[model samples]
Target: MEKADPVLERLEGQIAWYDRRSQYSQRWFKWLKGAVLVAAAAIPFLAGIEAPRLLIGGLGALIVVLEGLQQLNQYQHNWITYRSTCEALKHEKYLYLANAGPYASAQDPRALLAERVESLVSQEHARWVSAREEAKKTLEKLGP
Candidate 1:
């Protein structure tokens, strides 16, 4: 028996999406870095024990591959970016809900909320696109 608010719905949905992505990226970044550290730390120990050259070489390659994946996918960047967006969105939501900040002076607070929410989401999308393009350019610069 309650009417749903589209603006609030959008705000909440975006918050959840960004938060989820931030957590996911953070987890992946940390996991990949951890793997690289472990592999690297093991290399010296293995070498000291006179392990096969192939094994040591493989560990070095593993470190490269893991670090490359982290750079290419930009998990750390995404984690920070998404987390910032999520926090900004939450700040807007709280302000709108409390009729504080810019919402306080708006005649149509819902419309203002919608506009602000869309703007935040749009800015984030633009940043995401830029990040992809930057990654592409970096790859190109690296060449074959």
Candidate 2:
């Protein structure tokens, strides 16, 4: 049994976290968008067939609600952001492994790797905190 390298572990963990979040957000974003599109497209069809007014109205409301959810949650933005972070982490890992890029002239690649890994994760956390704060302020402005 060997001690695990903390830098490698942190790098792998962050990569996994971002990748999972990216996929989850992407899935939700696509599902919601697809639902909205289908509901929107069905509107005219329902109208043409003289569907019940209540049914048509319900679908219209669904579209509005779904779009609102998408906008509010920002699934697309999260998906893209998380994915980009994940790839950035991967790039750092590769560069560290190859002792290239910023690590090419480093005295301690492992320590540098840890520092860079933490930096990337910290930046992501800062962005998330900022976004949440902005959303809170917007909601406050909107009032209850």
Using lDDT as the measure, which candidate wins? Answer: 1
Model 2 regions more than 4 Å off: 137-144
Over 52-120, each residue of candidate 1 has an lDDT whose tens digit, in order, gives 999999999999899889879999999999999999999999998899999999999999889988998
- The TM-score measured for candidate 1 stands at 0.95
Name the lDDT of candidate 1. Answer: 0.94
Which candidate should be chosen as best, given TM-score against the real structure?
1
Candidates' RMSD to native: 1.0, 1.7
Candidate 1, residue 121: the lDDT equals: 89
Model 1 ranges off by over 4 Å: none
Clashing pairs in 2: none
Look at candidate 2 and tell me the lDDT of residue 64: 81
How many clashing pairs per prediction, in order?
A: 0, 0
**How close to the true structure is residue 117 of candidate 2, measured as C-alpha lDDT?**
87
